[model samples]
Target: MSRESGTATAEATPIHAQVSNLRPRDLLSKEDCLEMFRQVYLARYFDVRLIKEKKRGRLKGTLYSSHNQEAILVGALFGLKPTDWISPIHRDMPAFFLKDLRGDWNRPDRIGMSIEEVCAQVWGRVDSPGRARDNWSHIGSRSKKIIHSTSMLAGTIPVAAGLMYADRLNGGDAVCITFNGEGSTAQGIFHEAINYAAVHKLPVVTVVENNQWAYGTPFELGCATPDVADRAKGFGIPGLIADGQDVFDVYDKVMMAVEHARSGKGPSIVECKTFRAYGHGDHDDDRANKYRPQEEIIAGRARDPIGVCRQTLLDLGYISAAEATTYHAEGKNASEATNEDFPPEVVDYLNAGIEFALQSPLPAAEEGAMWVFKENN
Candidate 1:
């Protein structure tokens, strides 16, 4: 992954010759690669299961499918430390559980939210980390270092910057990673937050999941530059472009940016070129199909993240061809894919979460107004 400077190009060009000498992915052992593959499957399974639940009318709220964008969440979070901070938006619900989930999926002490908690949030039960006070993807845990996000896109960037600033003041060296869609780049808060982080040299890595269409508007109509990372040039920061379909590429690019920030090099913008596999949310499915060309949709989802990761593992000799065909979850939507299409562990994991969510109780009626104001001593 090349470190980009000036206008962000469609292709990455190495800014320093030494960068090509070794990549973050090169150091990964076979076990690590296998874990990454499993994580991808886990993310896909989570999204698929939720879509199924929503359709069954068991789960309320709009379901934002992270269908093809699994790689961005798994890869970006795989290399992050438990102490690191992250802010995931509506499209990134899987990220809540994927963070700090590299080795142990059931570790009680992990910094990431448990699958049960995420499921509880979706079910609007009190078991959610936020106690079901907020709706979908709006919950966060300060202890876990996940920033709470609102509907306002790119609004969390400044929050991330402020969090890291306070951490630095307290002699902490934590880097904050905030996720956003391509359309959020046009928001005034996006520019304002990045400018503040840049001026202060704060360790904030802004990840732009450039899924071709931001809701109904296409990328071309929203931004002038071919690459959203080009906007980073104005702040004099490194903007990197990664193949969002390839998990390894995303990991490499994000790790590079992480290292830069950890070394006190300030902030970076990692533009991951991926496509939204489905409608922005389940509610827009019919409209999305009508507005987006069938050819464009087909082209965007051509390279499924799970398929890409599987091929990488095959090339590295980590998995045999037979193993690759054992579970063919890729290219199949939630309705088309079944539990048998995923690994037993992945299926069981989500099953347990859903079961727990179903059993969890809803918050008391009076709880809604409890957190509205903080009482003074």
Candidate 2:
């Protein structure tokens, strides 16, 4: 519940400060450069659409969107093998770039279908996933080993551990990764998962997307430690702190973690300190300025992960500035198209949710009048 700095903006750490300082080739390659931009841009566009829809009452659910933290998820998955598994939180859905290799996040119809049908198949909920018990970002099938994300805060670590144990039993070389937030560090499950991972040498990498605030309180007031990465030492695992803002740093850190785990080393903790440019939930107040200086946000704006990445592409002559501008304009237009494609009414959605919940019937009601241990005919 605490942060690394006081009200004043925290000084840029060496890990993040030298993003522009790296040699051009060390940061990215022509082959994968544009792909990174596409993923980050798509994530931002998806978030903008979600926020606008929430405001318009077309989408009645809360959004823990990844407006600014796209680089961490995108970069980490850049080199993942098809056999690898990723378990992510709701906000980290930008990894859809990796999840749906053939799907287009910018298509309005597709995105709409995804959101409405993700949880329903019988009703074929318009935005639903068309599958049972595994909708909305359920990228992994039993054979694929990808686990569905739980909305519960800090709850996936042990689940990832169990998957790793499964891998060990089968003598598989695959790995499991879980992405959580800085706020989740306060949860007991976070510590328990890491402790077991370290003690048992599980092949799991815990990535912390640190945005400095736990909903309302700044990190300084939320936790006892300044750097959440420091907590890894207590579990006997290697702690790697990197700049979530720099796609290069994030990639390098992830690659190293992948290699370490593949080499039979224990699980490790990677804390990527980054920002959450949007609000906590769809209707939540940002209150970001109250916790930090306006100047920090403004300064932080200069090197937006998406902007910095595209600029790097231009500087390297991978794409002309005119092309970059066109690409961006195209992305924005696609976002608008997607946003308009799926519009719903608020009352209708509310009633639908209630009916869906009620139709299942309450299991407790059947046992309510029965004794604690009655088994007679």
Candidate 3:
């Protein structure tokens, strides 16, 4: 199958078709492709490790596993410029560290949060950008260009649009990508924000991680269209779809949307079709298993994002057959997979973050009252 072939819907006209010869991924060197593959491993390792920690009572709050949805984070983030902003929701914890990670994982000047900071947020330590005042997935850095997300679904679209509008006024070309689940598309803010963005031609790319199931509700129950990308038409913007399991496909589609937004075309919706491998959160895991069909769960996780990306690399001759079989992390849950299943560097990188989080102090008790109200100077 060609790279462009597969679950990517044909509803939205292809933006890259005008270019004819060069798709975004086509511009990637062999090293860039390998880096994308490595990032997938990093994302998977982060989610599984966090699940293990929460299970062992070492972490707090809910664990929203991004098991099958790793491609969306890795692919969508890979093509972004360092200055571009992103708003990652509860299930997108890996995105905090994944943004601007392409060949600059350790660079202090990169416009993305550090692994240590993300780990601190997960651990609820004082070193968190929000100083542990907010819980997991609530931390954001203005310097890093990441928007802090709230519990309200699809709420950040307006914030992202407003941010980009201000950036344009200031003569900045920065684009903001807001990540949300398919369920959030049902919210009124989703329409209102996108409509506003369309009118202003703001550089906002709304990435709907349509993972089939939204909490206890299925996609069919909440959405009128089979593909969430269909919603983009109403706003007079492009709505492209990608095989959420394929990192390359996601990169191509999202990069198209990103380019469209950056060129002042306006906001676009790139719906990456995927499945929620686990429940809405760790606490709801058992209930999710019971509510969703056994066959559906099995089928949903069949195309592991790591495995898909690995196969693509193999097809491209980037890795030998022997190398492909070296580490088998895909298709295994946190309990089933071990550290050896991933690259040692990936494990070590996360270990450093965990160590930092462990040594960091908790927020002072008075912090709860400190940010609550403002005092007259």
**What lDDT does each candidate get?**
0.90, 0.61, 0.90
**lDDT, ranked from best to worst:** 1, 3, 2
**lDDT for 264 (candidate 3):** 84
Prediction RMSDs, each to the true structure: 2.8, 8.7, 2.3
Q: Over the stretch 1-377, how does candidate 2's per-residue lDDT look in tens digits?
A: 23332111222122322445543226465767767666665556556655665567554555676766777887777756656777777777556434433234334432122322332322223223322333344443444345666667678889888888888899888777788888998899999988988888888988888977667767877677778877877887777776777676676676657666766787877788787665575455456555557776555444567766777778779888677665332223223544332222322332353345334332344444555576789
Q: Whole-model lDDT, candidate 3?
A: 0.90
Model 2: lDDT of residue 127 = 28
> What does candidate 3's lDDT look like per residue over 21-107, in tens digits?
577888899999999999999999999899888878898888888989999999999999999999999999999999899996898
Worst 10 residues of 3 by lDDT: 1-10
Q: Candidate 1 has which clashing residue pairs, if any?
A: 8-230
TM-score per candidate, chains pooled: 0.95, 0.71, 0.96
Between 2 and 3, whose lDDT is larger? 3
Off by over 4 Å in 1: 1-20
What is the clash count for each candidate, in the order shown? 1, 20, 0
Q: Lowest lDDT 10-mer window, candidate 2?
A: 5-14
